[model samples]
Target: MTVSRALSKPELVSEETRNRIEQAVRELGYVPNLAASALVTRRSGVVGALITTITNPILATTIEILQQGLSKAGLHMLIGETRFSPEEETKMLRAFLGRQLDGLILAYGYHTPETLALLQAARIPVVELWDLPEGDEPRTPVGQVVGFSNWAAGAAAGQHLVDCGYQRPAFFGYEDARENLRWQGFRQAVVEGLGIEPLRYNTSAIPHIDDGVAVIERYVRGELEFDGAFFTNDMPAIGALFTCQRNGIDVPGELGICGFGDLPIARVASPALTSVRVPAELVANTTVELLTQQIKAEGVGAMLNDVGSELIARESTARRSS
Candidate 1:
């Protein structure tokens, strides 16, 4: 009991006893079996996180911050990449829950019924990142959402382009739920704010820079016509910029482009790409705070925390000089 208490809740143990325990631990080089400890305490001291992909810098940055926050709280983080596959995500979810994780964080909210059932059976606190569902409907498997509204972010991007005097704009992105929401928002904003219906093109489930190049190539071939374009994320936006340069299409002069997730490359591009900035650090901190509360058995309820996004305008979307 003394050893268990000392290892699990050190603050409750006396300094002398703790010192003795430490000395013994060092001499014995004994490692505590976390699985065994979890059986007694019902706390795993670990959190499981599932992200669509780590290749995206935005998601990568969020995970990094979240890991740091969890470490500061003396907790370990186990991460899994879903590769945007529901089957893979379900497998990872089961695997993590089998390990008795204290909580779970998911970058994507879309899950199958079986996955949802597994999460419910686990009864652990879950946080969904990246985007929240529209309306007041609580369709999420987990009640806690930590991230900005992709719809709002998309609307902001559209409004910025409209304000920059771009009438015929197009949207380029994947057909995923999150990207669909962004496209819907952008299209709605462009139609209402500018009184013009924007063209849209959806690529594969996994978006790549090559997708952007292809979209631009279509435009160059007169297959698509638009004065401005909004990419779901920076990867395609940057690619489109490169394609435009290669095709001798003057940015912001002949065509304006904007992207979501203000990645680092946005600023360094030849014509800096305008983008919507999702507050990754804020999202991570808030997710950790909410998860901590949940792990402590504090009822956070169905809280939807929108960290918000900012529209960053740059040379890519600059208005033509009068």
Candidate 2:
């Protein structure tokens, strides 16, 4: 009992006793069994985080920050990738829950009914990262959201293109709920604000640079026409830029290109790509803070933390002085 108390709650024990216990532990090389400790305390010191994909640099950076923050709080993070599939997400969630996780962080807000039921039954701290649902009454599987509006970010990019005097613009991205929201925002702004119906091309799924290249190739073949294009994410935008270069299209002069998620590569591209900077660190830190508060039984009810986004204009979309 004394050793367990000293190991679990060191502050409750006397310094001399704690030192003796620590010395004995060091001499014996005794590693405490976390599983046994958790069984007695009913608290697993483990948190589960699910993201759409681990391959994305922006999401990877966010998860890295989250892991660091949780580590400082004496919590371990187990990550799973869902690949934007609700069934896969639910399966991962069930597996994590089976392991007795103390909290959960999900990159996607949408959820299957089974997943929602499981989460509600678990009654653990849940945080949904990334964008929320569209419209004023946004519905989330969990009440906690730690991200900015994808629509607003998309709108800002669209507005910038319009302000730059691009009459004919298009939107390009993959078919995902998050990207769809961005596309809706971009299309709404371009059509409503400028009264110009922008062309849209939503690829099948998990669009790569080759997909972007193919779309631009189609445009070059006279199948599509646009003076500007707002890519939902940096990957496709960078790809489109490469396509334009190979086809001898003068960017910003002949075709203005804008991307979201102002990733590092965007800044170093041939013509520095214009992009929307999502607050990745802020979202990760805020998620940890909120989850910590919940774990401590603090009153943090249905929180929505919008860290906001920024539009970074670069050579790809920089307007020349007449």
Candidate 3:
């Protein structure tokens, strides 16, 4: 009766009835057998994961960890790709919800009002990863969020560059707003702490190894002079590093490079890349933990948890001026 009241006519059910039902559930060892329960509740017994693109090498590891964590929590994952379009994202949301997912994990920041309203109407747990809008109001069936400070990671990268005493550092970053925060933080720190302005180049295109190769080559041919560069990500950083070596520029001697995400390649490059280590597995586990709490209606409030990041100095960025 409690399950019927809470799941069917929650509005008609009194608080006392809900509590009594919950208490009875505990005493009777009644577990939510989602397989059987889904028949009654019309849920799909799955969590919908909407991501930008699964093809990106960096995000692939994140997806792997997320899948493992979600699976361990007894939830199957249904995936949708947005192709970086808001309209497509909304469409994907409608499709995912049509299947009646028990929860949603969005790689993009937040959902549109139409999608949000639908989730509220359905009363499902939603988790937003990576980025989020500030000062969002609490909508019913509110989402629980967990992520790191991209800006803080960027600032730390800046501080590292400054501390290394590179007279001139160039910043190569992608056009994505999420990546821009890191570049902005990096630039601000370099300007304020060292009283020096770093040269900045925004990649009009998405991040790619060839993009890194081309930029470094262009700089070399044009006689641009810089002691170091902070590539927004590891792949491009590796590209730049090899480009420098090919051009007879001594890495960490004539140039220093740093990248973000600290992918395995970062540690395996000829000179291991010095990078910021983002705890992907921890982020994945924490996200699932928060979702689990939400599913149990455990009084989760507006969460701004930072899994945090660290700079690991490797051979690539280790050069000190004599």
Candidate 4:
């Protein structure tokens, strides 16, 4: 009884008794059966985090910070990569909810109806990261949001391009909803700034740096002559910049380039890519704070925080005169 109590709730045991128990545990290489303990306590020291994919460099820091924060709060994180498939996310969510979790964290607010229903049914703390509901919607369907505005970020990118005196700005991105929202924002800024309709490249391909090279090649061949372009991600933007350098296309002089997710490589690139910096650290820290509060029964209901985006204007989008 004393050892179990000490192991489960160390504060309840005397200092001397706890020290003795710890010494014995170390000698025996004792590891408590969390499953059995959970059966009795109804509390699992585990939280499940669902992301689109582990390979995305954009999410790497957020995931690292989230894991470290959760660990410090006496919780363990179980990560599941849904690979951008709603069906896969639904499957992972079902399994996590079925078994045990003190809380749940998702990479985005978008989900299938079944997934939405599952979130509604679950009693654990639910957190949505990376995106917020579209204009005027006060809260996400899940009613907990901690992210920046994709639309606004896109608009900022477009506006920056125009501000740099790029007459024609084209966009390159995937067909994802978030990408579409960004394009919409970008289009709004371009139309408002230059009174010209921006081009949205028609392609179903993922945002690879090679796509950027191909676009630049078209410009070199006179097939397309966009003075500026916005890539929904930094990879393609960097690719385009590199292509420009190799083809003798003057950056921010002949062309202006901007990207999303101001990755580490964005700054170190020869010309330094211009990008919208998503608040990964802020999002992760805020997520940890809210989820921990929810787990502790702190009555934190439906928190909606918009940690606005930061536009880092580097050499890629520097003024034409500069």
Clashing residue pairs in all predictions, respectively, total 0, 0, 0, 0
**Lowest lDDT 10-mer window, candidate 3?**
132-141
Candidate 2, residue 79: lDDT = 95
> How would you encode candidate 2's per-residue C-alpha lDDT over 19-92 as one tens digit per residue?
99999999999999888878988888999999988988899999899999999887899999998899999999
lDDT agreement with native, every candidate: 0.87, 0.87, 0.76, 0.87
Residue 294 CA displacement from its true place in model 4, Å: 0.7
Sort the predicted structures by TM-score, highest score first.
Answer: 4, 2, 1, 3
TM-score for each of the candidates: 0.91, 0.91, 0.80, 0.92
Q: Which scores higher on TM-score, 2 or 3?
A: 2
Off by over 4 Å in 1: 1-6, 11-29, 135-138, 298-302
Q: Where in model 2 is the C-alpha error above 4 Å?
A: 9-31, 320-322
Residue 266 shift from truth in candidate 4, angstroms: 1.5
Q: What digit string (tens of lDDT, one per residue) describes model 1 on residues 238-282?
A: 889999999999999999999878999999998999999988989
Give me the runs in candidate 4 sitting further than 4 Å from their true place: 11-20, 136-139, 202-206
lDDT (0-100) at residue 40 of candidate 3? 79
Candidate 3: clashing pairs of residues: none
lDDT by residue (1-322, candidate 4, tens digit) is 9999998788899999999999999999999999988899899899999998776677889999999999888899999998888889999999998768999999967789998888778867888998888854433548578988889999999999988888899988878777778888999999999999999985433457887898899889998868999888788888889999999999878899998889999989988989999888999999999999989888795578889998999998888873
